[model samples]
Target: MSLDDRQLLRYSRHILLDEVGIEGQERLCASHALILGAGGLGSPAALYLASAGVGRITLIDDDTVDLTNLQRQIAHTEARVGQRKVESARAAMLQINPEIRIDTLAQRADATRLRELVATADVALDCSDNFATRHALNRACVAHGVPLVSGAALRFAGQVSVFDTRPDAQGERGPCYACLFPEEAPAEEVNCATMGVLAPLVGLVGSLQAVEALKILSQAGNTLRGRLLLIDALDAEFQTVTLQRNPACPVCGHLTAA
Candidate 1:
């Protein structure tokens, strides 16, 4: 995809970077990203991906925008309250870059739909606020051999990680989301609606998710593959921990065995 004069000017900052020169910028302009959920996390992720010139972005969410979502879901507006999340987000993304394509799915991301979407996406982002949706997206990415950028935020804490199922040159596959948080684990469900999250925490984590997705798509730099990033907003601390793929993980373990 050759960048026209207008595109080159619009993406001049990215093209100026040595890591993301003309070639990397072009890669971003040709990549497709699938985003699940258009809430807090998806807001920044979608906004940045569009502003960065990702060619196509598909956003899926069944819910409608509410007054509460305005605290962190930046893609929505007061006028869009009660509108479908995917529609709200689509309008915001296109506002950033009208040249890019935005697909809005005002429906739940079920197993069948996720599998099909992941198969066509260059990268899939798990921006959903719940474990069920996260697990489903992870499974589809694993099955389709697509990279997954997962993010979550609650209270003043947040975490983001990238799970690339594709094997590296050494034939080693990175851990999937299930490897980090098992589906059967006795984990309590926490969300911004109940726990009261700081407005910027979601922005911090979601922005990181977008950064990782862009890096993976453009092959610009090393991503958080097999690594977890933890952010403590109250203490203003950041931590990165190494992650190992669980050979017994029900989702991606079979690939290792095969």
Candidate 2:
């Protein structure tokens, strides 16, 4: 979809970039993003994607806003405390850019639901807090050959990465999320609820998720396909670690076999 005069002005700063001129912005405007979870990470990620004019965004989350969520979940307000997270997030996103389409799913998705959602998305963002959901989303992305942007935050530490093993990509294909964190391995389910987190930590990770997602949607810049970005907000330290695909990954190993 071509950007109208109003849209061009709304996204003028993005259009000014040589790498993201009218063509790139158009690509973003025509892309669809799937965001899993509508809490802290999904909040900033969803809002940025909305403001950037990602044509459609499907947000899936089965939780409702609680008074405890106001600390970091910026998409919800005090008045919307009892509202479903996806619905609250949808309202916040529409307030940013009403021209785009926002789809809300207020349910905990199983494997079948994840497959259906990933099939239609141009890119998928893993903002869910649990390992179960993350693994499910990663598997779906691998099956559909869709790029996956994953992020997480706990305490003052955060990490983000892109896992895309699509056959047509140049150079060696990168690891899927499951390649680095094997699904068979026991994962300690940690979350902000049990282990408290810094407010801005999630924001930083979520924003990076948006940056990576936009890059994939626009074909601009190198994604963190084979690298993991770790942030230590308390000490203001940043680290990038290379990730290797596990040939025996239970979720994505079949891709190599095929």
Candidate 3:
């Protein structure tokens, strides 16, 4: 696909990079991504993905914009309160880049829907705030052989990781989300509602998730395939923990036959 004059100017910066030249930018423009939430993480991620000219983006969120979401959910404004999250986010995305296709699913991301979405998407972003949702996304991605970028931010802490089902040149398998935290390792749910999150904290992590998503889609930079990036906003510290695929993971393991 040849870049038009407008696309050339719009993606000039990306085309200027050696890693992401015209070809890579085209690859990115031909890719599709599904974001599983329209909250803080999804807000910035969808914004960047749209601005970057990703071919298509599907946003799944059952929630409506709330007054409290203005703190970090930049996509939703005070006037948009009470509107469906997907509708609010789609409007913001179109304002950024109307060239791309934006699909809005204003419903909860259940297992069946997740599987269908994952199958069609080139990459999946787990921007949901709950563990159950995260687990469901991971399982769907693994089943469909799609890469997943999982990110979370609450209070002063944030984390990001990429789970690629495809192995690297070394022939070693990439770790899935369950590799970082085993299924049986207790479950806890936290969000900006109960524990406040800094405004820029979510933007930082969410934007980074967008970065990882693009890299994975274009096969350009080194993704966080086996490394979990941890960020401490309060003290401004960053850490990386190595992860591995768990052979005993109930969701990803033994299900290759199913």
Candidate 4:
């Protein structure tokens, strides 16, 4: 894909980077990203992806924009409080980059829908708030061999990780989400609604998720494929832990064995 004069100027900052020059910018323009949820994490993730000129974005969320969401859900506004989250996010994303395509699905992320979307996506972002949705997306991404960038934030804590299930040239697969957090584990459904999250925590995690997604799509730099990043906003500390694929993982264990 060729960038015209206007596009070149629009993305001049990206093109100026040696790592993300014209070729990388074009790669970004041809990539497709699947994002789950349209809340805090998805807001910044989708915004950066769209602003970076990602060619296509498909966002899924069943909830509507509530007044309470305005605190951290940057994609929604006072005027869109009653609108569906996906619709509101799409509006915000398009407002940033009208040239890119944004698809909105105002529905929950189910296995069937996730499988279909993951198959078409170059990379998937698991920004959903609930464990059910996260595990569902992880399953779909592993099944389709797509890269999954997951992010979560609540209270003053946040976490981000990338699961690149696609095989390398040597047929080596990276650790999946299930390897880190097994699906069979008991549900610990804590969210911002109950815990009262810091407004910037989600933004920080979501923006990092976007950076990893762009790196995967544009082949710019090393991604956090097998590392988990943890953030403590209150203490202003960051930590990274190495991850390994579990041979007994229900999702990607077979790949490791093979």
> Which residue pairs clash in candidate 4?
none
**Residue 101, model 1, lDDT:** 91
Candidate 4 differs from the real structure by a C-alpha RMSD in angstroms, to one decimal, of 1.2
Worst 10 residues of 4 by lDDT: 249-258
In order, the Cα lDDT scores of the candidates are 0.93, 0.93, 0.90, 0.92
Candidates 3 and 4: which is better by lDDT?
A: 4
- CA RMSD for every model? 1.2, 1.4, 1.9, 1.2
lDDT of each residue in 118-180, candidate 1, tens digit only: 999999998997888889999999999999999998899999999997888788899999999
Query: How far out, in Å, is residue 239 in model 4?
Result: 0.4
**How would you encode candidate 4's per-residue C-alpha lDDT over 1-258 as one tens digit per residue?**
999999999999999999999999999999999999889999999999999999999999999999999998999999999999999999999999999999888888679988998999999999998888889999999998899999999899999999987776677788999899999988779988888999989999999999999999989888999899999999999999999988888888887533
Over 4 Å off, model 2: 168-171, 256-258
Task: Give the residue spans of candidate 3 off by over 4 A.
Answer: 255-258
lDDT of 3 at 12: 97
**TM-score, every prediction:** 0.98, 0.97, 0.96, 0.97
* Candidate 4 residue 17 C-alpha distance from true site, Å: 0.8
